[model samples]
Target: MEAVEEVAAPQVRQCPECGTEVTVHVRYVSWCAACDWNVDPGAPDPDRGRLAQVRRRLARRYGEQLAEEVARGGSAAGRVGADRSTVLAFGLALLVHGVTAGLFLAAAVLIIGGWHTGIQPVLGGLLLVAVAVLLPRPGRLPQGAPLLYRADAPGLFGLVDEVGAAVGTAGVHAVVVDASANAGVRTYGFRGRRVMFLGLGLWEILTPQERVALLGHELGHFANGDVRSSFVTHGALRTLGAWHSFLVPASRGNLMDWLLNTLLFLPRWAVYGLIHVLDGLTMRASQRAEYLADAGAARAGSAGAAVALLDRLLISEGVEAHLRRESVTAARAGGGSGGREAREAAERELWERLAARIGSVPESEYERLRRVSARRGHSVDDTHPPTHLRRRCLASADPRPARVVCDGPRARSIAAELAPARAALARQVIRDHAG
Candidate 1:
């Protein structure tokens, strides 16, 4: 008998019947052990096997094209990971608290000195009152105008409808927020369904497919019930941070401020330290959450496209930078009919600039910093895994290590079928309801 060909270890053979890729080091045979399909050179697993072969062939070709695009200056953008809005809000609140506390401390010092510091107390009280009134109101989001309700845009209403249909669930509404470089879904009210929030700039930066992936990821959070947990965690952090924001400024002085200059400098590091701890927990959850979302996007359809888009976004300098560079590069690249190509050129230019600006770090210096950062294992109070980790997570074939969902070609098919419908619904939700 002719020797049965064996695919190398780890790299599994693509399934002929289901188009699912698999690996087996057990034994070489004339047919697939899992599906009982022919493996003989002349008699592959019938028509299904043939189809599988075709899919792989096409995927390989597409992969090559994508690689070329990347080589020729097609780079992905980065998501804005920092919660700038929250940080600013916290900062302002802290300033108010610190100023008020200082005033009180000064007045008490004067009283002790028998100088009758009555004005200080009045000023302190008024400042405290003003902060109390303003703190509860919405401060700002990272992007967009203000609110992200779907009723804001009419043209994209059809997109939302499709997403609802795919999940076979309701109590979900979509909105567009003027937040910075982030997009996500949330749930509010007693019912606790998914409340989707899309960033205004996200779509402008992402291709339609990538946008779908992002939406799917958010929806996945709802599907996986991570949204509730995340909200709970976020709420707790917010509450604690707020408390620190208020009290730290108050605590900056011991009895000394009363005895001396009465200066109550805000404890910036102390508050930030607490935040970093909270952010660490949030970051761990976030990494897992991203995987789930990626899966959701896969389920919605277009897994390859979704992954491809992610690769694109994550590799770029970032969305904000892209926006800053867009106009200048567009004018320079001028009159190109190919949008994708033009965009690629712009991104390539941007990266080259950034790389140049970053300049050449000495090999030894780069190594030292890399080691130090790794040892530190994430920054204080940032809810994100390292960028490298994120790239690996998104690139993973089986995202859920615990509960293994389908993967390889089978997984791709399932994702491809559902992605379009889901994407359409998402668009609609944002357009019709973001008012």
Candidate 2:
């Protein structure tokens, strides 16, 4: 008997909604990264969507340029001029604070010396009061901060330590697990010890390799010294904001009050403008630092894994939105009888759907996502680069073999270890949602 001939998958020319190349798997329904367009192979094409088509075309062109840049050995590596930028940002932060301090000291000296008598003394006193009110209070750790329960996952902590060592940092001081769809490392305490917060929602969706990539990216921020400069600049900006808030008069009062407010207004406005400028500068530095951290992630894992982690993050955002909608719908239907349990069940269902969707994402589609994400620029205040730009940077970097091992068994063990903390956090989230 003749062997049955194997059929090749059909080639997808363009997305019915958006004109992006659907590269592989034309037979199956696929998602377009450019416009979130879903292509149904068996369904009839709807009306021609010109706007999405135009956008996709522009995105493809831009992506090609970025790819060419990567090929030409562009400076996608995080190390290029990162140290200089960090140093400059830190120095500027110090200089701004130093100048403010000098002014305060000079004002104090004048006030104490009794250089101005009579009304001058009264004005000086008012000035001192204003300054004191405007001064920024030292930041304190939140009373119940380190919000998530400390993970009992020794394997997870060991993985973190491996990544930390790879990045040349001592290691995180603590590891906390939460139920939210996020992961980050923060500096805490007077000593500025690093604390890693791992979100179970994010963890549940990621593959073992992607988990390493996420951890590496967060730890990379500390390894690259992003937190220190960020803290200083952010503190300075907050102080300026406090000054602006206090100096602005809430209402017109007596003639003397009005006069004093008028006198303070210009300086306060100047401070506000300075804050905007400084914040913009620091934001740029922060964006650069993010790219550096992405590079560090690439170093800790493979370039492919780093990029895949970003893609999963974007996918997870969509999943979260869907989960929230489901929660609201379920709550409305059941009159919120089961509360947390119902929500948890819905969450589980949503996660299963998310996992299936992630598993079905094609390589070509992920690449398209990288390109499209790069085309969209962030606002001035945003600290991170666009996801596509981050992916592009990672793609340009040399692929590194991951040092830590996180196979299926290991991943399961880690999850099991954190089960208690995850359950507690999940309950908290459900309660918060119900309320």
lDDT to native, each model:
0.43, 0.62
Candidate 2: worst-modelled 10 consecutive residues by lDDT: 1-10
* Model 2 vs. true fold: TM: 0.70
Q: What is candidate 1's TM-score against the reference?
A: 0.42
Q: What does the lDDT come to for candidate 2?
A: 0.62
TM per prediction: 0.42, 0.70
Q: Please, what are the lDDT tens digits per residue for candidate 2 over residues 75-156?
A: 5333424445456656766766776676677677667777656555666667677567545454333443224333555677
Root-mean-square deviation per candidate: 19.6, 8.8
How would you encode candidate 1's per-residue C-alpha lDDT over 329-383 as one tens digit per residue?
A: 4444444567556544443343233333223222322333333334333221223
Output the number of the lDDT-best candidate. 2
Clashing pairs in 2: none
- Name model 1 segments beyond 4 Å from true: 1-155, 164-174, 177-180, 187-195, 227-231, 249-282, 315-318, 325-382, 386-435
